[model samples]
Target: MRFGMGQQRITRAECAHVAALARLELTDEELDRFTGQLDELLDHVAEVEALDLEALPPTMHALPIANLLRPDTPGEVLDRDEVLAQAPFAEDGQFRVPPVLGEAP
Candidate 1:
């Protein structure tokens, strides 16, 4: 029965109705729990709505961001034998990996 000014409180019966509409079966305890949870969510929404955010600029992120990418440049490749020597497993001049699609019979 508690609600802030202009805040419409959600009732247990309304919660039951919504559950029925969604084809959800809930026990009395679950219905009671959800009714309280829904009220808290609605109260939070109302609190946010009361805030004056029009003076602030809209932004996708909190801080300024810029691309830090560097131009791609060609570099000398490592010798295949040298690279493969560091690998735990290799076959036919390539890194060997476990079968991912399926296991061999």
Candidate 2:
């Protein structure tokens, strides 16, 4: 299907080729549907490209952004013994977890 007045059109064969490269198995109906959808998307892109955006400043986001992180400051450290006592399993003054990779402890 054609896109807008002079925009390029997406063909079913091209869509099929893309699907093959992506290891997709689309039916004939799906190919037709996707081709039309892609054509519409390209038309929208063309319209956007035709807009007068020279005066507008380029921006990553629509709204103003600011860092929300708090200041990093030194904090009180917890006692190792107290923290180990709260754990379900502790060994040699450390928290003990089950073997993950079948390695001998």
Query: TM-score: which candidate is best?
Result: 2
The clash count of every prediction, one per candidate, is: 0, 0
State how far residue 9 of model 2 sits from its true place (Å). 2.1
Residue-by-residue lDDT tens digits, candidate 1, 1-105? 456865658989999999999999999999999998888888887779889999999999899989889879988999999999999878999998768986542
- Highest lDDT: give the candidate number: 1
Tell me the spans in candidate 1 whose CA falls farther than 4 Å from its real position.
1-3, 6-8, 68-78, 85-105
Model 1 weakest 10-residue run by lDDT = 1-10
RMSD, model 1, all Cα superposed? Answer: 4.8
Show pairs that collide, candidate 2.
none
What's each prediction's TM-score?
0.60, 0.67
Model 2 residue 27 lDDT? 91
